[model samples]
Target: MATNQDKNHPQLKFETKNNTVNKLITVAYFITIKYNPDHFLTMFKKLYNKDQLYLIYIDHTCSIEVKNMIQTYIVHLSNVYILDSFYLQTDSHNKYKIQLNAMQYLLNVSAKWDYYINLTDDHYPLKSQYRICEYLSNNKEHNYFIYYDKSRYDLDTYNSNKYNYSGLIALKEATFSESRIIPYMSNTWLILTRDSCAFLSYSKQVDHYIELYSKSLLPSNSFFATILLNSDYKRIIINHDQRILFSKSEPIELILKKIKSNNHFFIRKMNLTSNSIIDKCIEDNYQLPLMDKKENKNELGLNNNQQN
Candidate 1:
């Protein structure tokens, strides 16, 4: 079991505001990146907040140059940490282990954060940090992720022998005989509460499931949802992950349209090619000086009217 540490870590210190409305809801972000350090840096700058914690994992497959580049960029930021000891191919069940490690590290690092969010290098924030924190503060009790029972399509794909897997069959058989726990699937993206994160990080049941799913195909996709849904945490589960998924084949215009129509906080699979769209999203959602200037202008008008 992971022990909760004091809010003030000797290495880092964050200020707590007295005003509830102005208080920032701190988030611990677990980020996994393999390639494209440039794109990762861009997203990192946008998401960086002194109050939040970022634990970044660079895949072992990446070159040393890539690793150094990332390390150099975030070296000065106390809140940002690179998980230099962890090296895993994120395409497999190792992704699940990486997240577990991050959860434990985050728990030990500080007790001040309210939520944990996992992201990848391909992801970009649809809203500013302030906006995301505000929304999370308002919806503190809810956990966000998309989950459902195994679909026929998924079963067919797994059973088709497209990938080598004796583990999936064994897991299904074991679950069938047990009748207490069943398999569940979901996307890797999640916004989990600190309590839920603690449960996942330290539970012995989670350790058992880790052993069971170690050889299963795409364990990262199934592991988190299966545990949360089958546990008491299910009561706080919300089906939406608050993220927009995009494909490289999709038209930029259509992608922008979808982003505009949706209230999602983040979007994934973004690359340098989509810089224009990313810029547009930032312009619209980021709490920039332009936005503050506009608000100030409006406030001045209100003040004049009140004086009159």
Candidate 2:
């Protein structure tokens, strides 16, 4: 039943008009070598509407067929773009480089957008796009970067003794160098402001950290967090990303509870099975237990016009 058009093109039609309910959201979708182009096309269809823009990064390690498919199908859409391919290495320093390259590309081409969110194909939005943007627009000043000080632990001794193997053995893994400005770091799934995007793109401090952590494992986790923490934006950081999971042990019911509770906007590491569940939940208008929300007086003025 697959027509030639169906075989070659995505099922959903891409939209161009900008009718977003809140601020424009620019999403960076980083695709690894093994990502299914067809599945991605399906997800893209769901995520990209008139209001949002998608910048997709396909790694050089992806097959020629995959690359061709992305070029032929995904890029032709009005809102989707392809960043220059970089080598995506596993358990290596170059893994971080892959992310940074995509980030730089996104920053260079994006002229305007309120929030920049990094995503992989596995992430699914728990709320409608409107709700996601409205929530962020309401809290526009906060940087959704989860940060924690690591200097308290003896990382060097742990690294030397091989107690908790992270499976990220690269050129060399060492303790946090005393030279590091701050002891805070986390993975790169961040939803930060345009100002933070510009800062990461152009800041000399970030460049220094990039070079310093080039030899470290998965520096994307540390590079941006370290720089943002040391910069003037430190106080605005919320130390949490609603989209990420702290552990796989967190029960699915607990996760669904959180989503119903309206404590999170989106979640990551989803596959076909959970994706179906999420789609159904959203469709049925399910409501999780409500968590207490503390409104900031300063954030109240962020979208005051919405009040009137």
Candidate 3:
């Protein structure tokens, strides 16, 4: 159902201070959703751009009606795709595998993007797409993820399971290996460069660690950081994911205050109602004046307000 117009949509570009023109950094985003189809669609609409790519994985356990609804709604979007291959269980290791599979699928779909971002249904962007692209364009070489050395935590009795593997043993089995890759834990969210994405998607060492971590508890927390930290990509890694974690029970007004005070690009655990409010807040704070808007319109030859 994709149209020629969708395929030929104008790419986003910005001019540098030295008067050179450069393409705005394009992002490939993969989102995993399990429930609340309507909420997911709303988030998708807010984040969608024809110039970028989106791959959605709906948990197979989700109802058929919910899955069909999401599919039918995004059917015409050329840049949006749904992963329909296999069921993803709630197991921790399965989540790690799903991320790896999604990254590989994205590499097969397009190699033009500059970055890869993974999100869940509860996440929402705090900054506009233009702002995100602009920031990334400025900092293209760095990868963003928050990581901690495994030695920092006392894993003695943590999330123990019937496998009877001691926490230390599980950590070793999950991350450490004969290659001497030091184990690290990280938040699941990440912002990785295209090269890092390719490395994680196709590298042999990454595959080895994937197999090594197959049975480890909460491998998703360690797999990516471990791989990147032990590789040459470690030099470009930035320890911040640029996301604000918010509790659903928190007041929206306080959340708005925190958002205005901080420079995070996204927030998580937001419901639809709170998301709408935050969206308005971003618009008000970042809205350009009429003269600037006119100049941008002339330069880009497209309405900045247009959404997919």
Candidate 4:
């Protein structure tokens, strides 16, 4: 009973055998209105491993048939959970709340994980689960995020002509705030530490701040970054999310070049209609050595720790 996907990509059947790393990572995947369910399923199948947990959230606008299809695809996987449908508006103005809700849910359900990563359904892994786990394990305490500093750029760059505030004002407001806490620009996807998630989930100040900005535009983009950068976790922020590459569809050659040069672990907005892109990515990534052993030892300062 092998399906077209199963027959075409036999390696997916051996995800566990291929992923020998032991570190645990949790993922929260948010789906937009336009994603292909089949592509999303393929992405999950490729990244699946016993050491990780995957939470999927579908936009409320999607039809019940779509949800049922997603449910059927992932129902058999013990590690994958489908969240209740929520109004995940694609409008830039209304996106913050949905992202926050997904984050809040992940934090509540899987607080024990070492690291948690957020991704959109359009994203696909550039590296295998073992490689991603190895990278995170080597930098156990560091959080990966991309943020812009106000010193180099003006605060007004992220704001509107009508209003300007010092911090997140509301989820849909047109103004931008220069947070003394930590002024950062907008990039939603990030990887954070478990403790950071706990702080965001439980901190009274964070709760109050979020309440104030509940109506603010893109609050999720800045709220967590502001909290982490303004707090004790500030120094540990890595300022880079290695899992994603932002370029739109370029030839595979250029993408490969970027991967080697930048150490990217994933890329987004790939063509869902074709498997050639993912096939090439997997072939190239699998041939590359897992994170450099010596660098892991020197960077993490472990005594000959072995990854199976």
Candidate 5:
């Protein structure tokens, strides 16, 4: 049933689960992978449940045969709804646009879910889904979050930052730009409320801002966190955003100790390809690193999507 996307599936609208009213946690996985269609699915299946809704988007860069194979497999599953058209997120020239596009697709498809998780094809949750579901069902007051401030680390000058693409102009803009800019950082992976989901729904100015900044930028995800924290949201608390590093170049044990030193909740930007990353995260026993979020929450519950 899979035709060339441009041939017959030109107008692509991936269908989500038919209904969603009782599920405790709904995770939207918008992913673009380099190879092996099942590379994404294999990771997803280990952490997800039949009750949790999945709206999958594949890239057209893959062979139609491969695309068909993935689509056929996903559609047959009850909870995993198959999206027909595969878009290209691999082309370097359009990476930013396609990444955002994938996210938008996931958001629209997930219009009927509760919790929304944005993850890379490589991200896999280490925590037990049941444990997560139980915790979320019981505690409904906080926002899941993570943040880093290059400004706080004496690197506000920009030229010294890791990628060095951002510089004095960016710093001045964040400090005194008419936009009243501020800088925040995160690992790009996140689990957020439907409220946060709707809040992140792209607006003209927001998208414009993103387009302006994301061009030629190396770490778009880091900038996104800065934008969100500076926004009206207040419930965000610092959760660990580092996947425990096993690269001997950086000590994983020391980093875990540093993370636990702060008591943060979640971590990200992990080599989810590795079995050890999941094992390391679980070894922490759910004792997360964290920071106070009181200064951040505000009139941010935009009342955006009402009847999902």
Candidate 6:
């Protein structure tokens, strides 16, 4: 029963034995596609499990047959959602809508899950499922993870030259809203806790501004960053939300080397066409501290709950 994974030993049990389960994470994939997947589905099937609720959305142009076919393939999945009947995402620079389209699905679809992740179609993990989960479990008590330089002024102070831009936006019919900022941010692969998810899932005020702004062209990065700064929320953490930018293959071994030290859960922006890149990363002698499935939800905080 012990196979290559065991042979490689992605994670050492003794290393993770002391870690505790942190928070409950719901990994939701908002895949928007023009064509039904042939090869990528197989990769997704391998990478994903019943634990993740894959919320896939077709761009309205895809045929019904393809939708159902994909639906049938992903067992234990009713999390898939079709986009607005009239919405057409192709050729439109509507990253706001694209973001909101996915959000709408998550908000209306499943309410029980916590720590939902927003990933794109091109995104793929460089680590095994088991590896990521374990690390999260270890950090459960810490609500805040990002390290900000103490020299910087308070984030809410607009004069805090550390940032480029920030703002809020709506998701749907005056129903939901998300505040975001830019410049200081990278791509939006935020691993939000349950409380944060709840606020995003059910806020009408935030939704109104986002809806108006989504209709125009603004900075995606700034929008979320702005949201983080303005909100009553205690702290905002930022890093490479997208794991590794999947432009073209450089050195799979080198990439894995970085991920291990980073301690962040996911790396992404993959060339979906190339399966070999991932295979090589997995096969590489290079090791990452792969966390267990039960561990992805944990974080620790020294003074997290104490209001400063």
| Candidate 4 wrong stretches, greater than 4 Å | 1-14, 23-34, 90-96, 154-179, 233-235, 246-252, 272-278, 287-308
Tens digits of per-residue lDDT for model 2, 117-236:
766656655555666666676666676766665555434312232455554432223535444355464676677777777777777767776666655544655667666665543236
- Cα error, residue 98 of model 4, in Å, equals 3.6
Q: What are the TM-scores, per candidate, against the unseen true structure?
A: 0.78, 0.73, 0.78, 0.74, 0.62, 0.60
Deviation of model 2 at 171, angstroms: 14
Tens-digit lDDT track of model 1 for 174-254: 443465665766778889889889989998878878766755666777889778766543336667787878877877687
Over 4 Å off in model 3, which ranges?
Answer: 1-22, 156-170, 173-179, 248-254, 274-280, 286-308
Q: What TM value does model 3 have?
A: 0.78
Worst 10 residues of 3 by lDDT: 292-301
**Going through the candidates in order, what is the number of backbone clashes in each?**
0, 2, 0, 8, 13, 54
Candidate 3 C-alpha lDDT tens digits along 26-94: 888988887566777767766776677888898888888987787666766677777764866845768
Question: What's the TM for model 2?
Answer: 0.73
lDDT of 4: 0.58
Candidate 5 TM-score, C-alpha based: 0.62
Q: Report lDDT (CA) for all predictions.
A: 0.68, 0.56, 0.68, 0.58, 0.49, 0.46
lDDT of model 1, residue 210: 76
Once fitted onto the true fold, the runs of candidate 2 whose alpha carbons sit more than 4 angstroms away are: 1-11, 14-36, 90-92, 154-180, 233-235, 244-250, 274-279, 285-308
| Model 3 clash tally, residue pairs | 0
RMSD (CA, angstroms), candidate 1: 11.7
lDDT of 5 by residue, 1-308 (tens): 21233333333233223222244555554455445555566566555555566655566677777776667555445555554444544543354455455456556655655665545455544444554555556545445556656556554333123455444445434433565555555555555666655555674445654644543233454545555555655444335332333344566666556454433333434454555654565556543323333333333324542110
With a 3 Å backbone cut-off (N, CA, C), the pairs that clash in candidate 2 are: 260-288, 261-288
Stretches of model 1 off by over 4 angstroms after superposition = 1-21, 151-171, 233-235, 251-253, 275-278, 287-308
Q: At residue 84, give the lDDT of candidate 2.
A: 64
TM-score of 1: 0.78
